[model samples]
Target chain A: MAVNKRETIAKNIARYFHDGDFVNLGVGIPTLSANYIPEGTEIILHAESGFAGQDGAITPPWDVNDREACDRELNNPKWADKENGWKIGHKDICDASGNLAILSKGASCFDSVVSFMMARGGHLDATVLGGLQVDEEGNLANWMVPGKNIPGMGGAMDLVSGAKKVIVAMEHNAKDGAPKVLKKCVFPLTAINCVSVLVTDICIIEFIDGKMTVVAMAPGMTKEELQKRTEATIHFADKIDVMDIVEE
Target chain B: MNKVVDIRTAIDKIKSGDKVAVGGFGNVGGPMNLLYELEKHPEINHLTTISEDFQMSETPYNQGFTGLLLNGQIDEIVVSFFGHKKAQAKVDAGEVKLTLIPQGTLAERLRAAGAGLGGFYTPTGVGTVVEEGKETKVINGKKYLLELPLKANVALVKAYKADRMGNAVFAYTAQNFNTAMATAADIVILECEKLVENGEIVPDQVQLPGVFVDYVVHCEEVHY
Candidate 1:
């Protein structure tokens, strides 16, 4: 059976994380890895937007009453509720600015700190981020597309370079059937020589000894087909196995 | 001096062709009330905005600078992440210019300006496009790029609470770029959800001192 590319990539990437790992999941496919974390392993997930230590997924039962109460306080200065009433057992739900508001429905509670300190201090054990293209030398070019009006390079550069290990989770090929795993990245690079592993829809490629080597492939996807899709030279591992992706 | 003012008066501090630094990561902690007020003043054009993230999340919370960008108020943006499709369309259409900086470097630059430093050296973007025209120095067998401090004519910040004296406290992740932007601008405007009397907040609770604040406005709702 053919496996979903995003699920396969996310599942394979989750295997690299261990217990007590300070993992940063970038937006997109990497964020999906949270759903595939093994049952017993404890991973402290950090979001650069300012929350850390949340469980895999941000489930809901969010404190709606607390949000309304905070909203009331905002308009009425005479409302003397100094303390934010939105408390889910020591967890405070505030508006995005941290004001006492209804807890955001899909978010989990986390410790707050200066996000830059976490990024620059190199506190992350691993970062799973998406990539537009990853070169043979492990350089990442996920921020910009050449000649295209690219939005600003968000936290990808910091996360890619600051994390102890960088795992790129992306589709094996672009929508037009071009290889994203390339010999040389044609797009503007986010960071140089930073990517450690590549988890794509079709195969798991690792940059080892300065070469792009295929360590595993998706079920029924042959090495020959992966080679045809790739633009760079490829090598295969001796004990390649079908990727195991847990279904939700 | 007490710096608290209404949003209309706060918008008056911004002029045409001004460089403004805003605090927030996406919609979180953004000075939405101030930006909305500024948006109404169409004469305030050619604004060069400095921020961490430029794109809105396509949610209702997407109200701040994205609104300004959509209205064609922003001329250029110096940001770390520019992923909003709506804003990207503007850039693609040549309505806006973009300069991308590494996220860590952008934060440190703002911090350096607030701290009164000339410039600092960082290892980020040493050999990439970020290093193209910047000065580079090798110290201790390591390459570092000399990044200048980024200051602004006006800064709009979002805080959870503020005392009448303008001292502010930030909530959770909403404090992203606010504390740094607060001190790096000539005129600092704070949008707070709650206002307290002077001396009500403990010194330790103050994330930004009143000395850096020039204006404070009570903002009941800021989209995040």
Candidate 2:
């Protein structure tokens, strides 16, 4: 069995979604969970940019055939010249990353104030986010990388504080081969003891009573292999199940 | 009252060291025409901007705050998302001072200023670096950080349409920070894509009331 890390992680994460769940997917790998949502489940995706019921992201540089009209009217070379540049998808329909997104039929829009009100009011059920570092204490550190230019924490803190279940959907290791599932987070914390579950490339871990327990692992992967990639001492569930990766 | 004015006339209200709140997330809902006009004036320096995002670099047209940042027009930024690598370089080089606030906290702070509230306690940054140096109180056994209101000297807002009476209507999700920032500032200058007569926009359709608006400028929407 071929182990496609991101697809397997996304597929496994999708199993947690219940019907009629209002979920917020953060930028990066968490956004991929939208595509792998379990069949027959109705999940309303929330965009912090004042949109709820987001369907999916529009492919970049939305195809425009009228080059001359685009040039004369929009004056955006990206819109005019299709091959070289990117088109601004829609004026108002965008995800948190400023990429254009399509909305569901019953989607609603509001101002920034009302949007965060929903987030901070505990109206959301589940929030899946990308993480830089996650500790055994269920603390997540994802917003800022130390010594780099600080990109301000957008909405992670508020979501973590408000959401009933916070899921960290990311790769198990960083680009430098360091374990992101760490003994303790060296980076600044986005929130303390806020993460409920973690779906990584190699395993699905859940925080049960403040303990890191591996509930599932990727196909052909052993506990020793998973532990070798993880920095924290992990406990295993009684009957560990293989991650469900629906192949195309 | 006839609040409609030219773009330059509206842009002239911003002075040096003014606390300016701008609307927009990235390229959407930004007061581009007004900012474009402000970018021409090099004298409007040492300004503090309160916004949701940096209005990162867009292609074709150099719209949003990048022009102002490049010209050293902005000194301090109280924002939620300091976006773009180039904008971050400016911050790392000590060109602008950044006060990063969580997105919801930033929104609520502006709402507090607009609603005449003193401050709010939020559980967002309770155990994080964001709560450091701030007062913390335990309510119902939950720790919450005390975040204060943030008011601006001038607010530059964008609307899809506006009437002569200054009633503004926003389109779709374009009303991001524009609606909130409009209420939190002393002077609110609104730029609209279409300017109409007094009775053009219906009473119920108006997103921003005329009472809070000071000036209205008719400017075409710049396609990002």
Docking quality (DockQ) for each candidate:
0.39, 0.75
lDDT of 1 by residue, B157-176 (tens): 98889998889987765777
lDDT of 1 by residue, A158-206 (tens): 6775678889988888899988888999888888888888998788888
Candidate 2: CAPRI quality band: medium
Best TM-score among the predictions, by candidate number:
2
**Candidate 1 CAPRI level:** acceptable
Give the candidate number with the greatest lDDT: 2
* Residue A151, model 1, lDDT: 62
Q: Candidates' lDDT values, in order?
A: 0.75, 0.84
10 residues in a row with least lDDT, candidate 1 chain A: A88-97
- In candidate 2, which residue pairs clash? none
